[model samples]
Target: MIRGQCLITNKDDQYNDPDVAVILGSDKNPTCESQSVLMAPKIKLSSGYDMPILGFGTYNLNGYQCLTAIHSAVESGYRHFDTAFNHENERQIGEALRTQIQMGNVSRENIFLTTKLWNIHHDPRDVRRICEHQLNLLGFEYIDLYLMQFPVGYRHMCDEILTPINDISVLTTDVDYVDTWRAMEELVKLGLVRSIGLSNFNMEQIQRIIQCSSSKPVVNQIEIWPGFMQKDLVDYCRYNGIVVTAFAPLGQPNREKHTPIYFFSEGMKRLVKKYKRSAAQIVLRYLVDYGVIPIPKAGNPLHIKENLKIFDFKLEEIDIRALRGIKSKERLVQYENIKNHKFYPFERED
Candidate 1:
C-alpha cells in the first residue's frame, strides 16, 4: 500500500520488485530447475490477484524462531506470509522484513502480506481501530489483505437489531453481521487493506454477509485437509468465486502425547512410495490440486525445505481420487469453546 510509487530496495524483482539479487551472469542452476518450478502453477485468486501456490504459515511461531523462519521462507522464494493477531509475532514479522531489506533478499513490493483481526475486535466501531493497531504493530504502511478472524460479535446486547435477554457469547437473531461487514468494507475503501476476507465462518454467516457487502470477499481462509474436508462449505465458496486458503494443511502433531503421525494411511503410504515423496508433501500437494492453497507449518529449515518442495511432481488423478475416498472427516484443532459462541456453526447434525 505504499501509494505514490513502488520502489525496490531489496535483492531483485522475481515478479516486478527491482531488488532480489539478480545475477545476469548467464549461469543457470540445473539443480534448482530440476527440483521443481517445472509446471508450477501461479494461482490467481478471484480478483485477478496472484500469489505463490505455497505460503509460509506462522501459527504457533514465536520469539527467535518466528524471525528466522520469516527470513528463511523469503530467501527460499516464498512471497506470501500468513500471520494473525493471536500469533503474537507481528513485531518479529516486521523485524524480519527490515532485516531482509538490509540483506537484499526481498522488498516490500514483492510480498503479499495477510493478518487477521482477532475475534475480540469484531465490533463494528472498533474494527478499524483494531486494524490500525495491527498495522502499527506490524510496522507496515498498509496490509495486503485483512481478515475478520471469525463470525465473532458481542452477545446479548440490546440495540436497534434486538433486545438482550442476558449477557453471553451466544447472540440473538438481531446480531448485525451486515453492520460488521460494512465497517470492514470501509477499511478497504480507506486503503487500510487491499482486500478483505474471512476465516472460520460457516455457510450461513458468509451467505448473509456476501448478500449485503459492497465488495464480495476474494478469499476464505479456513482449515481444509484430507481428514477434515468440509465439502459443503468448499463447494459454496468456490461457487461464489472465493479462493480458499487452508490452515493446518498437515494434521497437527499431538505435541503433548507426541503420538500424532497417523495421517499416512495405507493408501497414502503406497502413493508416497510410488511418488518417492514424503507424507507431508503428498498431503500438501493433494490440497493444492484441489484448488486450495495449503500453508504447511514447520520451523526447522530442512522441514520447511521439504514442505515447499510440493510443485515438482503433479498429483495424478488416481492419487487424488484415492485420497478423497479416504477422508476421515476428523478435525484436529476444533476449539470447543466456540460451541458457546452465538455463531457456533461447527455443530454436527449427525
Candidate 2:
C-alpha cells in the first residue's frame, strides 16, 4: 500500500470528494517491467475530472519520431499527453494513439489528451470552427481538455497562416478573451470538450474571466522550472481550485549553451547522490511536490521512460526548501513577438 492515508477506488471514476488520494505502491525500483509500471497519481480538477499529475509533452515532435515517441511513452505508463494545434502533429499523435488502442496497449477512457486553441483563432466566432478542424485532424470524438493558447489575439490572415506578421511584429486583434472563453463553455455543453482552460495567462487576466463568465478555467499551462518558480501565480491558481500544468519543467534544451550553476548546487548534488537519481528526475519530483503537474518532453526512448520513474520517491521537506531557496529566476518561454500586444500577459521589460 502507498504511504498516504486516503483511499481511492475506481481509478477511472471522476470524483468531487476532496478526501480521496491515489497513492502509488512503495516500490522504489525503476525497471520497465509489466508489474513495475507505475500509475501516476491523479489530481482532481474543478471540472470534476481526474488528471494524471505528470504528462508527456509533444511540442516539436512530428512524423515518424512523434509516432515512435508516443509508442514508447504509452509503454512507459504515461496516460496524459500534451499537444497544441500550433505544434502541427495532431494527426500523427492521433494515429499513434489509435494504433496503441488497437494493439490492446491502452484505451481512450484511460488516456487524457490536452490541446490548445491558437492565438489566431481567439475570436469567438472562429473558436468552434478551429476546434472542429483540430478534432478532424486528431480523429477524436471529443477533446479531454481544450486551452486558450494565449491571452493575446492575432489577426486571422487565413487558416493556413498561424502567425500573421506585419513586418517586424505580429498583427494584433482586440477580441476579448472572455468572449472566447464563453465560446469554449459552449464546447462543454455541446460535448465537444470535457474541460476548458487558460495558458500563458496572468492572475489579473484569469480574474477578469472569472468576473465576466459563468464558467471557470480548470487549469493553467505555463513555463515553470527549478530556477524560474512562479510561486505567486502557482499559489493563486491553487487557491482558486485551478490546477497548474507546467511546460518545460526540465527547462529548455540547447537554447542555452551551459546549464545554470544552480542545477549543480551542493544541495542538489547531495540530493542526487542520496536518491540515486539524475538531476532531471530530482527537478521533476520537486515540481510535483510543489503542487504542479509537469509535462516534460524527450525524444530518446530511455529518457522518456526515465521521466516516468519519478513517482516512486517523495522529496523531503528540507530538500523542497533547498530547491525553493535557489536565487536565479529566468523565464525561458517568453513570446517576445507578442510583447507589445494589448493583452500580452508577461511583464514588459523597458
Candidate 3:
C-alpha cells in the first residue's frame, strides 16, 4: 500500500482541514477511471491554499476552441484552471465553470482558478484593473492564484532614438515588476486572491523578486519538457518550498509540426512500450517523477482520459534516470517578439 496520508477534495467544504489535499485537474471524467489509477492526491496551492495539481491550460486557445476544450477539461475531472486576459477566453472559461457547477458537476469551492496579469498591465494600478477585470469577466468571485506573467515591462516613454547629447537610457519607469508583485500580494491580503506567483522567470529574476518583496512567490509556472526541462530550477523551487508548475508539459503545440515527440524518440519510445504507455504519458510521468506539477492541454475526451490514466503506474528508478538522460533541452516556445514588443528574456545557447 502507498504509505502517505491521502485525502479527497470536498467541493462543498472549505479546506480548513490541513489533512485535506487538492487533486490536480487535467482532461478526464471525474466519475470514471481505471481501478488501478488511484485518485489524485489532495489538491491545494503551494501556500497551503486549496489547489488541484491537474489543472487546465488556456494558452493559445480561443473561441469555440477554448470553449470546447474547457468543457472537456471539466468533464475530465479538472477542477483547477489556468487562464489569462491575454488569452481572451475568460468569458467562455467563466461560462463553462458556472454551467458545470449548476449542473452539479462540481461545487464552486472545489475549483482552483488562476488567471494572470499581462506584461502590458505591469503598473500597480493597472494590475488591479486587469485582475479585477479577469475576475469579473470570468465571473469568479475571487481568484485562487494570480501570477505576474513576466518581469519585463515598459511605459510610453520613447527611447528608440539614441543620441549622445540626449542620452536616453532604457530605464524602467512604468509599472516596475516589484511594484506589480506588491499589488499581487495586496490581493492576497485582501482575500481577492488566495495566493500569488511568478511565471516565465529565470533563477536570477526569481531571486531578485524574493529579495525585494514583502510577499514571497508561492509558485513558478514555466515550460518544462524533457527537451527543455529545467531540473535544477525545479529542484531549487521544491527545496525552497515553492511549487513548480510545468506548462507546455508536453512538447508545446508549436512543435506539433515536428516528427516524433521527445518522449517517443527511439530511446524513450522503447521505454514507453516497456511501460505499456503512450508517449504523452511518458513525458507527463517524467514530470511527476520530478515532483513538478504539469498542466497539459487537450480537447479530445480520449486524450483527456489518457492523461488522467497516469496515476495507475509508477516509473521505475532506472527508467526515470533513462528518460532524464534523453536531453535535447529544446524550448518549443520562446518569444521572439510579440506585436511590436522587442525583447527576449530566456537563457538560450544557439
Clashes of each: 7, 0, 17
Q: Candidate 3, residues 153-254: lDDT per residue as tens digits? A: 645332221111224433334456777888888887777888899888877777778899876788899888776778788877777777888898887634
Q: If scored against the real structure, what TM-score would every candidate get?
A: 0.80, 0.90, 0.81
- In candidate 2, which residue pairs clash? none
Model 2, span 52-112: residue lDDT tens: 8889999999999999999888877787999999999999999998787777666787779
By TM-score rank, best first, the candidates go: 2, 3, 1
> Best-fitting candidate, measured by lDDT?
2
Cα-based lDDT at residue 231, candidate 1 = 82
* Best of the two (1, 2) by TM-score: 2
List ranges where model 2 is wrong by over 4 Å. 1-36, 264-267
Which digits, one per residue and each the tens of the lDDT, describe model 1 over residues 1-350?
11111222323222333212211111122232232221123456655565556778898899999988987776665667899887888889988976776665556766778898765556687788878988988888888878877665544232223223345433433346567778988998898888888888888888888878767777888888776778888889999988888998876755466433446456767888999998888889888778788887778887877887776567788878878876375676665544655676576534
**Which is the better candidate, 1 or 2, if ranked by lDDT?**
2
In angstroms, how far off is 70's CA in candidate 3? 1.6
lDDT of 1: 0.70
The 0-to-1 C-alpha lDDT of every candidate, in the order given, reads 0.70, 0.84, 0.69
Error of model 2, residue 343, in angstroms: 0.8
Worst 10 residues of 3 by lDDT: 157-166
Q: How large is the C-alpha RMSD of every model relative to the true structure?
A: 7.6, 5.3, 7.3
